[model samples]
Target chain A: MTYERPPTPGYDLGMSSSPIRKEVDGALLAFVARQRPNLLAISDELAPLMAALDALLAEGKRLRPAFCYWGWRAAGAVEEDLDGPPGERLHEGIVNAAASLELLQASALIHDDVMDSSDTRRGQPSMHRRFEALHRAQGWPGPARAFGEGTAILLGDLCLAWSGEMFETCGLDEERRRRGRAVYDLMRTEVMCGQYLDMLEGTRGEAAVDTALRVVEFKSAKYTIERPLHLGAALAGGAPEVSAALTGYGVPLGIAFQLRDDVLGVFGDPAETGKPAGDDLREGKRTVLVALTLERATPAQAAALQRRLGDPGLDRPGVDELRQIITDTGGLAACEAMIARYTGDAERVLAAAPVPEEARAALNALAVAATARRT
Target chain B: MTYERPPTPGYDLGMSSSPIRKEVDGALLAFVARQRPNLLAISDELAPLMAALDALLAEGKRLRPAFCYWGWRAAGAVEEDLDGPPGERLHEGIVNAAASLELLQASALIHDDVMDSSDTRRGQPSMHRRFEALHRAQGWPGPARAFGEGTAILLGDLCLAWSGEMFETCGLDEERRRRGRAVYDLMRTEVMCGQYLDMLEGTRGEAAVDTALRVVEFKSAKYTIERPLHLGAALAGGAPEVSAALTGYGVPLGIAFQLRDDVLGVFGDPAETGKPAGDDLREGKRTVLVALTLERATPAQAAALQRRLGDPGLDRPGVDELRQIITDTGGLAACEAMIARYTGDAERVLAAAPVPEEARAALNALAVAATARRT
Candidate 1:
């Protein structure tokens, strides 16, 4: 069921090759491997924890870290020139910051999968599902739900704790370290607040759609793109204006990324998305697409959708009908248009920013890839 | 139904004159009150979340933070020390660390409640129970259990994340910050390991008695007493040997503290403990007392005990029979004796530590008070 990614396009004409991405990934993998012994000593009973973490970590594309490294590079950092020594310390700092973003992403996913009650992620069984199976096999008390959640909660907390530990121990300059703290704090808080908004929208109905979108911007957009890029820029000792400019581009790009995800949630094939089609509809997820569909649906269609929404027993026909209604109402097209608008806006911002022309071209390519991702 | 605490002799020693505990408590409460606005801004949907966290935080005795502060004081930190100002900043550092401990404790409790599946904590409904109520009230889809767990897991993750933010943001000396990181990491890893061992013991049966004891030491002892005290001492720039000396005393005291809690889990009245009597027995918690009971019980008695060990449907008569078996086999007395031994050993360690005589007296008194608490 794994969908192979398309080959990456060539770098922009003006930009030269940099070993930043591979360097960051290598350092992070080595650091994590070094901590493995200590982690093993901590949980011999839960030996699978390490393996699970490794697998989850490996699934990520090092996009965030690349932004972090490029942020530094754009801030006038260069690798060892033929006549100069290597900037080992600066490179280390960039790698550390990059590694943190990946860790935070991993933490979010572990908790998110449990919150969404997802059965599969990245073409594999979800962590909660794996733990739930173990709970059932062992005949644990109360129900499998308790054990599944207990493990997920602990696992997420462990990731957060370790992420902080990594940030603290990453030998970065004092100024950059202080700057990084502000970004990290904002990112974590935003995610939590966004989660609260999402939950509220689900329960309170459509009265809060605007608020829900704001939550999406602050929570998912800021955390996923804007902040990661901002954090990397801050770590590279970028000027305040540079961070602001990056955010201008990153925010819209982040929105487009999530908007695309919402579309995929319903229309995406099960094999490619690693989720059953119309899963969000069955879960009653209050996404913008759902909101638009509700606003546009006929009275009869709206009533039928409402009846099926949040229904755990929703079957194939119900899913098909809901999808058809959404499509017929033009909600899908509107969502697609919104994604395109945001992507265009991000590219415009990038064009106006004072970044290197070559970097801008690469960044524009990244924006297109992110927004146009099919699965 | 309230069980009266025994009036221990010399319980009021220095209580009438001591202003240190009162000062620290005031500082902590004031800081928390000021931060209310910040917390409120982070969540509009999760109303229950803030309320539950507030209640849980309110219930903490601040015993760990108290130990930390005292450790600092014992290491020659004077109220008027010319080096650091006395008013807000220094106090905020200590309060932040204290608050971090409280938040960490909350994170552990949320996960533990899910793991244990008990209905109540601190004379109030547990977080999972609160979430379950919300699920039922809203008529949410799927089992209420899943919703309850999903909310609790997210809530706990938020607490862990917030705790790190607070710790990182707290203004403290670099040396002290480094020390704090070490203690925090150890504290987190130990608790998880301890939890793993605890879970394993329940499944492995009587053969894990020694392993269970080791779990108690790592999970409760090091975390509850040793680390907090060390963290506080280290913050005040206490010599490594000084904190080491406190550890010498804290470890045994922490073990005794857990031993007493284990005793209360079975024999203590529900009114005093705020949990149903023999709740641990019903849950089949594999405590030292349970291990002892199994070692001493006759084969027929052991069979009967095993039948009711994890029986959620065990009636009052069944619980009574289990209690009788524990008492008749002298397991209760043996447990009490063990508590006494550990407490006595803790006292000896306190006497042997290189602390000032006055500090030693205070620590000894605190140890006695901790071991003798009714709730």
Candidate 2:
């Protein structure tokens, strides 16, 4: 329905990503291309759904796939086989499995937006909003919002089903796949549970740092990096020690990555982040940074922070004030200190990790980029 | 959380069900028992979700699993394997696969309730309703309805994810499992697409008979019976001819099954059906019965029907009037005739099918029960 644009790679991380990005993109494109006719055969009206998914997919950076690829290489999977025919057979299967994660991510984001009543994603109208606009454009009967939310839910279900189908059909040998399958299963369940936990947190008046950190561990840290890496290593038939080492390297780095995201949620440029400034605060997310601020605030500052933290109508002045309070209370510095400590721990683990040479360099670069990204 | 009740076996058709029911229930109970502690490990607050799922699951009649078990048997899988050690291993795998279908059904029902904004399911508050009540009971902040819907969505996703995991880990040998996996994959996609089509139809003014039939074929016939039969047959490594025969018997029987449901929705006793009498009329479902009435109705009658079809406040008097219109238009008679014809067709196919003797008997009984049930 709109002008077709080729998918752009996700956040640059200031690194060359052509090789990994191409394979992941190729896998996803091929999968969707194959499903296109089947979906259209179901109904022409369904075409918009495919278009919506394609647009959303095009904006991904293949972050999970990249993590997966490097993890596989770290566990003795050869980099030389990444492009050649002999390597293509094994590499393609893993790539497809990696790409499946993107679909899973798409499913989660679509559903999450509906849950949050988010208006936009990736600088575009969120899925339900897009569908709502369609309903209004068509002058359809009944509530447009209900229709939009219903279709969005169904679309997300389709994506979730497709993600499973993709992974199961990824052509990996069953033995190697077993372990990865376990990780994949745990990752999916954990993410949903974590989301529930986060929702539960929103219902409460105050946030404990431990509760905030627990949410981080389940919702972001494990899902974003640890599980993907384990999934890749499992696919490569990594030994117990190799898997353990990847976990060791992954956890601290993933936590640091989330901390960086929390920091960026408040401080990053809207242009780079593709979100409104103070979007997290507007949404009333109980991030660890917010928890720390609550812990350290003076009485007046605490009262003000509590009053304004979840106020949906808070303006730029309010955000500036909150920022000043966080700074004055040392919440920002303490959070920065936590990020540095985790980054150091990750680097130390990577240094002693039983990984190949090239993989080590790539992983270190990724850790730096993950912890230090502005977007 | 409440007193546990043993799961009731699905519609009996006057046949003994203890053998099949025990195995299916055992598999489901064992699976849940295993996951309970792991879920609690994630967070104690998550207890209510598991409790809710357990309560929902406890009420199922295991219809899909029964169809699957019978299908497996028709394909020459041994009845003796239902009990003996060797038989237990193989039977247990199939049972788990069948149990997975129940979870899939649960997921669908949960989300479907949200979409339709239905208040009750299985004579109890639907998942969203339950969650809404929970929020109100706890005096939780924010919109209770939104919170309820969000949690229900996530819970549905969790069930969907668990269904896949259970299916993959059913422990069938890989080669046979591959064939079943393909069917499983197709079944999931088809059902979701069918649901979308059903929802889309609801947004339109009048449903055509042909369109209504298409919905029946996709949304119920294949998903409710044909696919489950095929899935079981596939797992048993049935020859193509056997699978085709099962489909022949299954398609008509499944369609008949849905027709029975539609009829019962209008005329059956509420106590027996577990729904209010004339619930379908109140919801304005675009069933074949409604389509036929539209085709045959006088202009005045059509106008009246259209005006009241989807009115949420339609009371018993309104239901009776609509019933009278349908009867006068011969919609009810035509629907009954169609059901009888399809049931006859199904019986003929089953009689001539090359299935094992005992299995054929069980299938015929199921068809009779499916088409003739008061519930």
Candidate 3:
């Protein structure tokens, strides 16, 4: 049965018709289309790989690219008139570069799904699952799961390399590319480390709140928000203070964004979030919310949470019981409060930053839309 | 219990103490050391991740960097006199840039080990196996295998990204790095696609000889040999013909090198190969040797080979049986002949190419050492 999404106010991730979002979509499609021939040149058997990548590339929020574009705007591109509307100042090369971040995100997601053995992504079968099914369907020999996992792993690797390749070939001059890549390189390393931390945290059982927050900081706050902004600022040749200010806003906002995602993973409708209900519960992600819940639970309640947490066979009733435990113990409220605080901090910092009015307004809109979304 | 390596007539990899090899080893250690602080800053837990990477980096053939260096030497760097020995012509920046290829190679090997589920690499526990032991030792929660694979996957990704970062930071000017990166980037994508094809071939059971040869073309010939030389030539700002000449030599030599590897996988001493005897057979690798054997085998022989192949639990007796079948069916002899033919082709092309005497000598020696060695 499909879990229906309740109506939420304002726009959604891929539903936004904004020019920046549209440009990112177009750039991603064009970039992927351009890369198809090389794989085909290797073998027609690689056609499935291209198809898998294409399907995964579709339907992103384009939020990272948005942050990047606004980062550049905040830095104030010298040739652009600050007085013009935001849509009027778009540069194709800059947008193309920003869109490359989506490829990085896709790579992370594909690998993450394999690590967690996830079945679904964005309401579709995960990359590994797709290959698993393909193997079964084709009556291929050997373990279907292994074949699927191998395909996903290799595809994830391809996406990782492609992200860098696409970024380099995005029609930017070598100087800009060289500069932007510093932040890009750091971003990749940080995210992988963050992932390692997240995986380690999981194995160690319930982690301290600080450990969970650290994962959020490295895996989400920096990778998703601060670095994208820094890449944009660096490309625009912005001042150090400009990058500093953007970091101030980006870090907090990025944390809030992830916290919201955490909430959605458990509570959001499967139809809206495009994931199975209680996926974090099933995977036993060491998010701050889980850490806080473990902190406040009584002995029996903690034991109960542990029994069902990370259980792949967890049923709907088990999910309800865990949700009840979290709510009763104030974990959910605490998580929401943290989100509010971080979002407020981001908004305040953004309000004070000396950015162009158009960028400022768009960023404010994005922050609200991101955090306030039910999904 | 261990197989002893028979002494070769001449110098072998990592033993000659050649200046180029020494430079590559030193550069790799220094580069990995420099990146350690950032990961430690993320979390002390990541210390193991770094250690795993360091241990894996400790020993390698370092062939890619050597190829890149020779490619540059062949192209004629304007600053260096071509009459000197290969060692004197080494530029630190260019060598460092070339050394970065080791990271890419490491990334591929780590992931390849995970995909193949091989327990050993370079005679040490494979990355996933190391993590598996760590998980068991620590008594971590969840399945130990999952944790091990996740760690390996993330580490492989870090190396992939680090390769690009190291390449950029290799002190080469933007023009050189940029030019070389085009080749580097293409090499990465091709190898991943090649890996995908290899995985697919394995699942499809015994495939056609053409399919197996295609895997060798993309996975080994281009990735291992051709691109590194092209990268070197491009960095030296060589003329178009220099790249073409290098490719003409590299492709055949690389094919020969892989054929040597396939033969070694079956027939070589485990000590020399640094892998288990019949590792490819255990993993069900659909090599050209396997394809040719199946083609030539009688029904009974083919059935006998199929029974033990890919059964991970196959013992020493099983390995011997498969080896006997391969030899009986003429697969081993055919593979040796192909290696001889390709090596001869490569040497002839190298002899005719308008390259400097010193470079020609080193490249010829490398070709001989690469194809003729037991390892």
For candidate 2, the TM-score is 0.93
TM-score quality measure for candidate 1: 0.89
* Model 3 DockQ, alpha carbons vs. true complex: 0.76
lDDT digits (tens) for residues B1-375 of candidate 1: 111222541222222245544554564456445545655676555556777777776775566765676676666665555336543366567656765776678778887887787788877888889888987898865467766766677777777877776676666756677877788887887787677667656654542457768888888998888888887777777888888888888888888888888888887777767788888888788888888888888998888888888777777788899999989988788888988998898888778877766676667767766778766
Q: Top model by DockQ, which number?
A: 3
The regions of model 3 sitting more than 4 angstroms off are: A1-17, A78-90, B1-17, B78-90
TM-score of each prediction: 0.89, 0.93, 0.94
- Deviation (Å) of A84 in candidate 1: 12
List model 2 lDDT by residue over A317-348, tens digit each: 98888888878998889899999998899899
Candidate 2, residues B240-314: lDDT per residue as tens digits? 887888889998888888888888878878777667878888787888888888889999988888889878899
Please give the lDDT score at residue B327 for candidate 1. 92
Name the lDDT value of residue A184 in candidate 3: 94
* Per-residue accuracy of model 3 over B21-125 as CA lDDT, tens digit each: 788889999988888998898888889998899899988878898889889888886335433344333377777888999999999999999999999998899
lDDT of 1 by residue, A179-298 (tens): 877887777767876776676566655523466567679777887788878777777677887788888888898888888888888888787676777788777787888877777889
lDDT of 3 by residue, A103-145 (tens): 9999999999999999998778999999999999999777899
RMSD of each: 4.7, 4.7, 4.7
Candidate 3: clashing pairs of residues:
none
